[model samples]
Target: MPTALLDLILPPRCAGCGVPGALVCPRCAAELHGRPACRMPVPTPPGLPECWSAADYTGAARRAIIAYKERGRTALAHPLAG
Candidate 1:
């Protein structure tokens, strides 16, 4: 379906908080940014390249990730990337 038509049928909401009119609201977007930190697992699996994340995986950030990966909120990719 065309994106415009789909949006009209089901308006986008903030993936993090369900706020109407945007894939992610300003407040939720803000929650997605933070100083980078290493996210290596405690067990340190073999060949697991060092991973890092900007925002801690909690609160709004966790919700947004769940929405994107498990709830079909693909529209959140851009905002989450930022």
Candidate 2:
């Protein structure tokens, strides 16, 4: 599985805090910034009815998205998805 491969290639580390164990360790992932309610577009072509993102793409959201897309940190996708 990709997780096994990741374990072999990259040492376990918190996606947000960079600690160690897994991408987006529970503690740091829980700490990642989030908001109440706000409409945002889905990250796909055929956008559906207005979707609401859990976190505003300002500080942590911006960083997590950039890291996942530009930096190829696919492991962070789940957490980013909120």
Candidate 3:
């Protein structure tokens, strides 16, 4: 099975931190923190709807955005879009 092959060849590792034995190791994920959702909207110049963001464009969110946008990490687009 593919699962068996994966287990044999490449042990699970955290996507973010490369810790062994888990796709996303809890300890490393915990270190990547997110702030409270302030729910504020800053209007744009071209009359676009005010943008609502959960956290500021820094840290994990920023990296994720860059990865999804510039680096073509389309896998994250759907979940992040919402």
Alpha-carbon lDDT, every model:
0.84, 0.66, 0.53
Q: On TM-score, who's better, 2 or 3?
A: 2
**lDDT digits (tens) for residues 1-82 of candidate 1:** 8544677799787777888988888898888998899988778989999899999888889999998788666777888888
Report the Cα lDDT for residue 59, model 2. 51
Whole-model alpha-carbon lDDT for candidate 3: 0.53
Give candidate 1's whole-model lDDT: 0.84
What is residue 73's positional error in candidate 2, in angstroms? Answer: 0.9
Tell me which of candidates 1 and 2 scores higher on TM-score: 1
Q: Please give the clash total of every predicted structure, in order.
A: 0, 2, 0
Ranking of all predicted structures according to lDDT, beginning with the best and ending with the worst:
1, 2, 3
Better model by TM-score: candidate 1 vs candidate 3: 1
RMSD to the true structure for each prediction, in A, is: 2.6, 5.4, 6.2
- Give the TM-score of each candidate: 0.76, 0.55, 0.43
Q: Which candidate number maximizes lDDT?
A: 1
Arrange candidates by TM-score, descending: 1, 2, 3
Output the TM-score of candidate 1.
0.76
Q: Give the clashing pairs for model 1.
A: none
